[model samples]
Target: MRRPRYYTPTEVSLHNTIDDLWVSYLGRVYNLTPLVEEYKGNILLKPIIENAGKDISHWFDPETKDIRTHIDPISRCVKYYTPRGRFVHVPPPCPRSDWVNDFGKPWWRDGRFEVGLLTAKTRWIRIINTLTSQEQMLEVCSEDTLDEILQCYLYYNSHAASYTWKYDGVNLDMSKTLSENGIPDKDEEFYQCLMDRDLYTESICLYFNDDLSEI
Candidate 1:
């Protein structure tokens, strides 16, 4: 027998720049529009939706009582704002350091911080270009892009902070798992989540390095 699918009402509203992909479990809104329309429609969004079925309408839409579960990643991000009136947005501060054991040493976990910063920067660039009547030099987007963009930010930040350390040692290898654990019949949600984390973190390290050249 095949496994059941999950969908969310938020995805339905994701045809454009919709904010707040509400997840009942999280109790917080997430940006999903970018994942739906931007970032080339993140590879994960479609599968989850296709499997969810029409019943997803129950959660948000009154027309259909389909128990929607997942939503577009980009639309999910609008819930977070750029704080005060600053062009730059810092990562949500942590009273305790987000330290992680990687590269055979202790490292500051900076992915969340970088993600928040990049999101602000991306939003700022768009706002500036919009005001100048520019041809939209900055990209218009949804919250879904934050995850991928954050990966790039963290990649660069890590390298700049601890250039001497080895990155591969801390990187999580998700691509390798898909090949090794090929369960075509199943959604591979567990494996994909791991891959997402690995990809996001490693990419952060790389993006951080590349960003240095601009400085």
Candidate 2:
């Protein structure tokens, strides 16, 4: 089985659109595109639309892993405390004849919307192909191991696994994460990489190791 894909906040932010909305909450990433499409003209969708491609952890209770709620002052009953505004599948503070709770499971509670886990932290790295003289910059999860990162590099080099990954001339441990492999994270100066990418970005060079596995 393939490993569960990990996504950084920056990557999640790219899908900020009605037809491709995504959000992260309680350390999990969710694809809210269908929910938005199904409720396209809904006024309740406003807050979600405005906050697309952003973290909504504040909207949920970490302990319950569900939406935050509070006792309504007027109704004197518990209600979703959507300070931003009531959103899709959330019941109204008071009973309404038009309101429907037929949707089996709320979008947030449904497993279908869950795409992946939110990375605890993100970092940038440069992958250089010594043989082809080609290079690619990647925004990867700090929790990713060399093997997992190799999967990301496969788009640039299909035979990435056949290449020996090295950092500062020492071989990399496929099972270990970047920092565990002795690669220091320059997160404090990570933004500087935007100005001089090559100067601050750490590089992992790949040396092709010819093998019969290649067709």
Candidate 3:
């Protein structure tokens, strides 16, 4: 079964620009660049633009999984609570004749803008090549499979896919997560022991398979 892609906060933060805005909320990440382009000249875009490449989880209600709401002080009626002012698709606090509700669905509820889910946790891992004795420290998401981790390792070793990965003397299942492969995350233990996070990393040895496809 295919799993959803996971993104670290650092990867999402890099897209903090007008043409590539991204934000995360409630463990989900969204690429709001289209929303930005659709409402380019609208002043309601201020908050979204200013907050590009950031997490706006506070803008939503965890249980309801929707935008936060509050009662209108003067009218004694409930309305969308936007301290930064209303943005695109959000109805005005008060009803207005010009307000239109024909946009099909609100951007927040639209899944089209969503890119992927945020990784729940991150940990340091060291990858060492048995062939050349090269080593690199990498921070990886707990939910990531070995194949995904290999993609990150490509920066260090271009022949990562040509290697057989192993934790100890046993071979690893590339389709499964690190935990599923019996490699437990020790980040919490490292933290409790006051160990230097930089010095504390799980070692994964890679043996060359002699595959020449990458060459």
What is candidate 1's lDDT per residue for 150-183, written digit by digit as tens? 3333433423332221223344232322112221
Which regions of candidate 1 deviate over 4 angstroms?
A: 1-58, 61-212
List per-prediction Cα lDDT, in the order shown. Answer: 0.26, 0.89, 0.88
Q: Write the per-residue lDDT of candidate 3 for residues 22-94, one digit (tens) a residue.
A: 9999999999999899988989899999898899999999999889999889998988899998988889877
lDDT of 2 at 56: 94
Candidates 1 and 2: which is better by TM-score?
2
User: What TM-score does each of the candidates earn?
Assistant: 0.16, 0.83, 0.92
TM-score of 3: 0.92
- Point out the worst 10-residue segment of candidate 3 by lDDT: 206-215
lDDT of 2 by residue, 59-82 (tens): 999998889999899878888899
Better of 2 and 3 by lDDT: 2
Off by over 4 Å in 2: 186-199, 211-215
What is the Cα root-mean-square deviation between model 2 and the actual structure?
Answer: 3.4
Tell me the lDDT of model 3 at 141.
Answer: 82
